[model samples]
Target: MQALEKRLKREVLQNGKVEILASSSWCVPVQSIDVTYQPVKRLKMDLLMKMTLLTFQQAEIANADELSELLLVEELFIQDLLRNLTGTGLIEKGEMYYHLTSKGMMQLENGIYEEEQEQETQQLLYSACHEVFLPVDIDQMDEYDELPDLFRYASEEPDGSLTFVEEELIEVLQNSREPEEEGEEQTVITEILSKETQQINDIPCLEFILYDRDKDLLFARVWNTLLSQWDDKLEKQLVEKEVVKWREYYLKA
Candidate 1:
């Protein structure tokens, strides 16, 4: 505390152009959220699809109706299934026959299919004061006991929206996530379903009120303990430009 005060006095206010009027410990609000997402899953093929693909593997069916009678399956069902297989590029449908394509041959051997489902949830964070999402690991945060209450940033409800930075979310999701082994199916978060707020928390910070002696004005500079640096953006947006409103807040405080 003494070292910081002396440094601030020497480097920041040595010219006497600005004065450090007050300083206090601040609690910056943060919201913890569970983001539910639907990932692209690679699953084993169903029995029906396996049977259908196997049929194509054997030989092309000249007429599904005739084959259906011998196979004890409905004719219309076989036709629809063949059309679906063609749609998925697993089989090639000729004008009067069906055959397996190269891709279909691989699927027949692997017996794996791609699907998009199975909701997975991950915990993440949001900086309410900055109105942005963060990929910060919560376990690494350095917390402190209650202290001098200077200011407490208000918390915001996490809406069911994926409006945050896409890269940040991707980084968070990809961290510590990987395929277990070679030839293993990799799960990717292709769609974010929802973000539900689970808890509201606060990160402690050092907030200082600076008085501009020349202009007879007041502003704030906030130090983010988590990042161990000054929050210039929050200072600029929250208190720097709005001198009038923040001055009023200071007086009220």
Candidate 2:
């Protein structure tokens, strides 16, 4: 500090006035800059920039669904956030997850940053998925006994709804259907819901469930009539393992 003071005094005496630009005042315009002596301070926030940054920061560690939960914001907004944060290296994307970087961790830990409230709400849902099994609220057989009609339906019903995987199946079907059309082959979907039984709304129906064994994620759907075409070894594994549920078949990964 004393050396810096003496240098500044000497410069002032010599130049009469100090003009600092991108580097320290002592930096000569043509000289190489040595940032070793720079002071650390908080970043300045501009109003619009702050809003945009905060929006991205809230979604820093969120996947699509998680981002939706986090920001309760529109899909476009979340997409924008994903683009911004990934572009800036504040967060990283993976096949199935997003993660906050060290700088993000520091900002959160120091309480120097504030994110959207939706982030907290989505976090709760994310925690619930991590804690409880998918197809979580299985109406207890005994509990449903109070309503014999419901119990009877539950008994006849298979397990799982398979709602979440519907979109995935549709994408697959579309791709599979495209090439075959040029070859005079018709798009024939055998079945998506297993021949096994599944249940939805206490009713037995075509079985289907979306299960992610590694993540222990499950979403149940009854016969959407759309997934019947997705039945195959991969789809079968999803049901048999109970990693996904469609009727009687519980899929395991």
Candidate 3:
């Protein structure tokens, strides 16, 4: 009994919630039927796991400070567990923090019935991605710019093909090329870009370009028009990895 107590105590220290689930009365049985019953009788143990994970997920929602306080684990430990959970699609890591993955959140909600909390978490994540692509006036930047060259320069000018460039080089060139007359009145160009008119002639395409601006030649263009702004080869790799992750998350037993 002393040996078993030490073992259980060690396990409880390793997983804080284990102590909460362990019932004192369960005893090892000599019969196979008793052992079978023991396995089936672990519903509370499963519940404890759900509650512990839900608590950690809630801490993530509340913020990093709360997470640190509530989880009682070292920062490094939390980071490792979160990384593993994200790799297994049990969590999602964003620019600033982490959240439960779709399946994780769904399981938590179904297991806990905390609908409002789950919806709030989902909205927060969705809004973060949504704001990234929303129409914003680029002219709002100090640099006064235009897209006439982009449209005129396009190899095949589609009606809505005047592309937007977020590359700093193109932005600098546009700003520096200004005819002193604009006098920092750049927002006009921004207002035009903000319209997102989308008509063949009126709507301009936008690309968030990033590269070494010092190069004299514009031989390579990184267009942000695709679902992910990456070259074909890089995009293929990303797609394959995403597919593999999806398979692991949904198709694996």
State the displacement of the C-alpha of residue 18, model 1, in Å, after optimal TM-score superposition: 4.0
The residue ranges of model 2 lying beyond 4 angstroms of the native Cα positions read: 1-62, 112-253
**Superposition error at 40 for model 1 (Å):** 4.8
TM values, all candidates: 0.51, 0.23, 0.21
Better of 2 and 3 by lDDT: 2
Q: Give a tens-digit lDDT track for model 1, residues 91-188.
A: 87678667888878887898887555568888887786777666475776775655344344454444443256555676567663664565546566
Superposed on all Cα atoms, model 2 deviates from the true structure by an RMSD in Å of: 36.8
Q: What is the lDDT of candidate 3?
A: 0.33
**Residue 109 miss distance in model 2 (angstroms):** 1.8
Error of 3 at 154 (Å): 64
Give the lowest summed-lDDT range of ten residues in model 1. Answer: 153-162
User: If both were scored by lDDT, which would come out higher, candidate 1 or candidate 2?
Assistant: 1
Q: Candidate 3's residue-wise lDDT over 3-63, tens digit each?
A: 4345544543463322221222111101000000000001112343364467657654434
How does residue 52 of candidate 2 score in lDDT? Answer: 41
Model 3: weakest 10-residue lDDT segment is 31-40
RMSD of model 1 against the true structure: 9.7
